[model samples]
Target: MPMDSVMGRARALWEGLAQVPVSFAPPGGVDVVVSPRSGLCPDGWVGVVALGGSAIVTAPSDGIAVLVRDALRRLPVEAVTDGALVRQVLPVARVLGPAALSYVSPAGFRAVEAGASSVERLSAAHPDMRRLERSAGYEDAGEAALDEITSPAFVVREHDRVIAAAGYRAWPGRTAHISVLTAPEARGRGLARVTGSLAVAHALAVGMLPQWRARRPDSLRVAAALGFEEMGFQLSVEVEGLSPDFSDAG
Candidate 1:
């Protein structure tokens, strides 16, 4: 697909996910809206997404939305997505991320040639997947969000155990949101890249735009190695008086 077309689809995906009517069109700035139906987050939460210098802010209630809009309306997309700036604006907010948003097109992807024969495709809900997540502990597993994926999991095993895994969940506008996890002891073995490569390839095969939302440096490196282009950033905040229920995050 052409670059413009790919980006158009990406914009549509995020707009749909916002749940409140919004757009990524030009005049590059933020659009703050209050919506109880926001797919970006649940009620009492705040989601800020910036793409190509344009942004959208979704808040759970009118008061919260008004507060955020008054504070961030004058800032550029880059600053709106900045954790420090956001914290300064809302002094008592708990920020979840300023995750780097990346996208891979068929023309931009660089697939890895894997020689690891232990890699196998399995269901994302397989018992072994649970074992792998447990081995990695709750924090890492949750960061990777592997359990939340809907696609087939591409996993690498060592000594009859799943050491690394990758997959993508179907998102709006036919986009694939990639997720990857590796066992604690299996770091630096390139297993993540191999499994991630497989996952990206599969998403591209089905003509879905692949998106990588990375919070860690290592995850960003993997996305870059696979030729995913960093396009923007996303930040989710829990305001001072509004408690965000994270039960749905998993």
Candidate 2:
């Protein structure tokens, strides 16, 4: 698909996720909305997603909405998604992320040509997939989001052990949320890029928009190398004393 079309789909996805009736923020500006839905975060927190040239903040209540709006009013759109800036502006009890949000168009994706020769594609339900996750442990496995994938797993094995793997989950707007994990011992071997390439190829074949949400430098670099453009950021902040007001939530 064309880059513009991909971008339009992305906007719609975020709008639906935000549960707002507006386009994303304008250049250098922020748009705040209040609803019961928590966009990208858990309940009683703020979810901020910045895309294109604008940013959107979803709050659980009108009161929290005002707090976010007032706090972010003077900042540029870019700063709105900055975790540190956001934490400083509000009474943040915790922050989930300020992860890099990237997407690739079929026309822009640069597929890896030969390195993934040893990869094997299997059902996500395959038990070895979970074994790989266990091997990677909590942090690496969670960051890869391997547990959430709904697509076929592309894996690399060593002595019958799954050492690296990648896949994606179907998301709204026909988007594919890509996930990749490489065992600690398998690091620095480019296994991630290889397995990830296979998974991305599968998503593109099925006409899904591939998205890479990464917080680590290595993961970000892998996305960039695979032709994904970093267009935005996603930050979820937990505010002190914030509680859901279901009376007006939608």
Which candidate achieves the best TM-score against the true structure?
A: 2
Candidate 2: Cα lDDT at 223: 96
Per-residue lDDT of model 2, residues 82-176, tens digit only: 88887777888889889999999988998875453477887887899888889889888878878789998998888899888999999988899
- In candidate 2, position 94 carries an lDDT of 89
What does candidate 2 score in Cα RMSD to the true structure? Answer: 2.5
Give candidate 2's error at residue 49 in angstroms: 0.4
For model 2, where is the 10-residue window of minimal lDDT? 241-250
- TM-score, cand. 1 vs. native: 0.92
Question: How many backbone collisions does model 2 have?
Answer: 0
